[model samples]
Target: MNYWLIKSEPSTYSWDDLVKLGSDHWDGVRNFKARNNIKAMKVGDLCLFYHSVNEKSIVGIAKVVKEYYKDPTTDDHRWYVMDVEPVRKLKRPITLAEVKAEPRLNDMQLVKYSRLSVQSVKEDEFGIILEMSEQ
Candidate 1:
């Protein structure tokens, strides 16, 4: 399955909020690249639920439960969203600082595209991040 990193500002929509809701449509993407990443998602794909803004860390895991559909929050037909449900919270959040310090993660999109709200994660990168969380 494909892996992704999905960011949300804790104040607006934290990992806790997602855990509480059980499942929610991931929407509000405005950038074309980020939109395309959303469109690429498939059912059973895993996503690292990142808390951006003040808390720049991956706090939880989420699974794609549904494929792309027209974004319900907007009237624009160009945008789409997918349903995701919380899988589990990380043993410990993996901070941006930690990721940047690791040489293996230097080429990661999270390091290269800091401003991206949604980004692809290579399987190795995904495994590395998961390992980091355990420590």
Candidate 2:
């Protein structure tokens, strides 16, 4: 399964909110590239739930529970969304600052494309982040 990082501002929607809901539609992605990534998602894919802006960290893991479908809010239907369920909470959230300081994670998209809402996480990078969070 493909692995990705999905960003949401804590003030807008925190990790706690997702854990409370169990599963919910991930929508309101206005960027074309982010929307394309959402469209590419399939059931069972894993996502790193990252709190952007103030929190600036990877707080939890989530699994895509449903594949992409037309977003009801848009009449033209260019946008799509998927349902995701929280899988696990990190022992403690790993900060973006810590990620950037690690030389092993220098190549990660999380560092290179800081503003991208949805980005791929390389297998090695994913393992490294999980390892770091465990510390």
Candidate 3:
């Protein structure tokens, strides 16, 4: 399955909020690139839940339960959203500094496009982050 990283500000919609809801529509993405990425998602894809702004870390995991659909928040026709099921929280969050310091993760979109809200993650990158969280 494809892997992705999605960001949300902890002060707004944090990982803890996701865990409480269990599953919810991933909406409010306004960036063109991010919007495209959300639309490209498929059911069963794994998502690394990243908290942006102050949190600045991967706090949890989620699984795409529903594919792309029209976003209710937007009046535009092309904008879309997805449904994601909360998977689990990482006991230790992998910070941005930790990620940037890892030589093996140099090619990650999270490293290359730091401002991106939605990004693709390679298998090795996913595995490395998972291993780091374990540590």
- Of 1 and 2, the candidate ranking higher by TM-score: 1
* Residue-by-residue lDDT tens digits, candidate 3, 75-94: 99778899998988887999
Candidate 1 lDDT over residue span 12-117, tens digit each: 9888898999999999999899999999999999999999989899999999999999999999999999999999999999999999999999999999999999
Q: Residue 113 CA error for candidate 2 (Å)?
A: 0.8
TM-scores of all candidate predictions against the true structure: 0.98, 0.95, 0.97
- Distance (Å) between predicted and true CA of 6, model 3? 0.5
Model 2 root mean square deviation, Cα atoms? 1.1
Per-residue accuracy of model 2 over 18-135 as CA lDDT, tens digit each: 9999999888777888898998888998999999998899999999999988877687678888899999999989999999999999989999999999888887888888898899
Query: Higher lDDT: candidate 1 or 3?
Result: 1
Which segments of candidate 2 are over 4 A away from where they belong?
Answer: none
Candidate 3 segments whose C-alpha is farther than 4 A from its true place: none
Highest-lDDT candidate: 1
What order do candidates take by lDDT, descending?
A: 1, 3, 2
Report the Cα lDDT for residue 21, model 2: 94
